[model samples]
Target: MDTRDLGCGYDFEVENSGHVFEVKGLSGDNGGVLFTDKEWSIASEKQEDYHLVLVKECFSNDPVVEVYSNSHRKFNPKKQITTVINVNWSISTSDLNYTEIN
Candidate 1:
């Protein structure tokens, strides 16, 4: 994996893949930018800048799943975004249960 420093955070690129994952470490009420490509149609609809966190997983034997906070705020169950996991994959969410890492 290759890591690049974005102004507000960092981006991770998985080997041999077109996907680029970005992460922003801003705090409450702050907004930051994430990955952008020509095919990002969702960005075109917005008049203002939007922010997103990027991640990449290339070595998983099964489909990877992710759980993240919504609205770019701190982690909250009411604002969680959980990706559906395929039946062929088994995942453990215990590591990601915390809102912040100390």
Candidate 2:
């Protein structure tokens, strides 16, 4: 994975898959995720290869993580452009994909 570490929204890139992932987290209360317009645009361009990794209660040891693979499709269920700079997405608990991480 590669860190962006500067301007241009989105966090890291997964080498070789042409897949880039934006990390998002909730406290089990906030209940949703947000992406910047630029970030979503980038993901949109990448289509089914982009990803969103959301963690519930991120500070906890047993946090619940949901991987939105091919986020363009997964996010389609609740994707909405909030403004010129932000895009809001609602994620259903049932839509989560769990990938085993070693």
Candidate 3:
């Protein structure tokens, strides 16, 4: 079943096997894959039941999919530090000049 829209952390789930898969698409044959905090957490918790499906050359005519089970143990993932900037501006209506447009 497709569960990506539900934000459950994984993309697809096998009903019979109860296994979850997270898919990553790349334009090139090989590259690094980054998972969100929630996804990483779920992958760690799911253990062998979690699968990381990497789709290579997704944009090309031919794409190849490689499935990795328990990827949390197969490879070490480094933490990616992200900087978030929040900008807020408060403008009073009195500071603005009104122009009439037809």
Candidate 4:
């Protein structure tokens, strides 16, 4: 996975699926911050400097996956910074062919 600057924030793209994800910085102190939405919600209060990834699984179902790291922080006095998270997903399945006679 690779990340690119998108002015507002950063864009994450998956290598295999080519799926893209975005991460934006919220205004205010980086404490007790919770990413809430109708689909999924991710809270990163414990990890002070972190990015929240909210993914919507279905119309009524969604899951928030948290990717923690120490790479996120405030570089300027204003304390405004955005971090991008890249995730590589891989799946493998095996099938067996069999014949039976009764």
Candidate 5:
């Protein structure tokens, strides 16, 4: 089932097998894929239950598909730090309240 929109960390899940998958699509056979902190954490927790599906040359007619179960055993992932900033605007009730409108 497609779960990418749910933000559960994984992209897809196998209904009966109880397997979760994260898919990485690459334009070419040799490329890199980055996982968010949440995704990495989920993968680590799921261990053997988690799977990574790599689609190399994904847009090409002949795409290569590779499935790696227990990705931790197959590859070592690096951690990257990204800075995020949130800007919010707020107004007090008093500011919007006026006794008379001109």
Candidate 6:
């Protein structure tokens, strides 16, 4: 669902739970994903139920997935472009629900 095209505002929109996901894939050595100002603007408007899914250690055969739910509306992690995303509240990984990919 991650697209190279710009201005789509997000990666995927799930129909079932009506949730949205902005996915980023990175190898463990690179650290966490970065959310741009444009992306943040979109997320701010659609914070109803959105998520940021970072698939870390992507180069490794077994990647680790970390989904930060409603992270858009939650934190104000400065205006810096390179900061790691932060969620102000607690959301269990299981609770950061997403649609199944075939």
Give the per-residue lDDT digits (tens) of candidate 1, residues 1-102: 445543323245455643344454433333433333321332333213322453234234442333242322432212234588767754458756744676
What is the alpha-carbon lDDT of model 2 when measured against the actual structure?
Answer: 0.74
TM-score of each: 0.26, 0.65, 0.82, 0.23, 0.80, 0.61
Q: Candidate 3's residue-wise lDDT over 4-102, tens digit each?
A: 899988999999997999999999998998999999999989999999999999999999999999988888988988999999997667555564455
Better of 2 and 3 by lDDT: 3
**TM-score winner:** 3
Q: Is candidate 2 or candidate 3 better by TM-score?
A: 3
Q: After superposition, how far is residue 38 of candidate 3 from its true place, in Å?
A: 0.8
Task: Evaluate model 4: give its TM-score.
Answer: 0.23
**Best first by TM-score, ranked:** 3, 5, 2, 6, 1, 4
Instruction: Output the lDDT of residue 34, model 2.
Output: 71
Candidate 6 is scored at a TM of 0.61
Query: For candidate 5, what is the total of clashing residue pairs?
Result: 0
Over the stretch 34-81, how does candidate 5's per-residue lDDT look in tens digits?
Answer: 988888888888899999999999999999999999876677987778
- Which tens-of-lDDT digit does each residue in 29-71 have in candidate 4? 2323322231021122223433434333323334334443322
Worst 10 residues of 4 by lDDT: 38-47
| C-alpha RMSD by candidate, in order | 18.8, 19.8, 2.9, 15.4, 2.6, 20.4
lDDT of 6 by residue, 1-102 (tens): 444375666788776676778888987846645687777877787786778888888889888888887777676667764558876977777766664556
lDDT score of model 3?
0.92
Q: Rate the local accuracy (lDDT) of all candidates.
A: 0.37, 0.74, 0.92, 0.36, 0.90, 0.74
User: Cα deviation in Å at residue 62, candidate 4?
Assistant: 21
User: Which stretches of model 3 miss by more than 4 angstroms?
Assistant: 89-102
Model 4 / residue 56 / CA error / Å: 17
Q: Among all windows of ten consecutive residues in candidate 5, which has the lowest summed lDDT?
A: 92-101
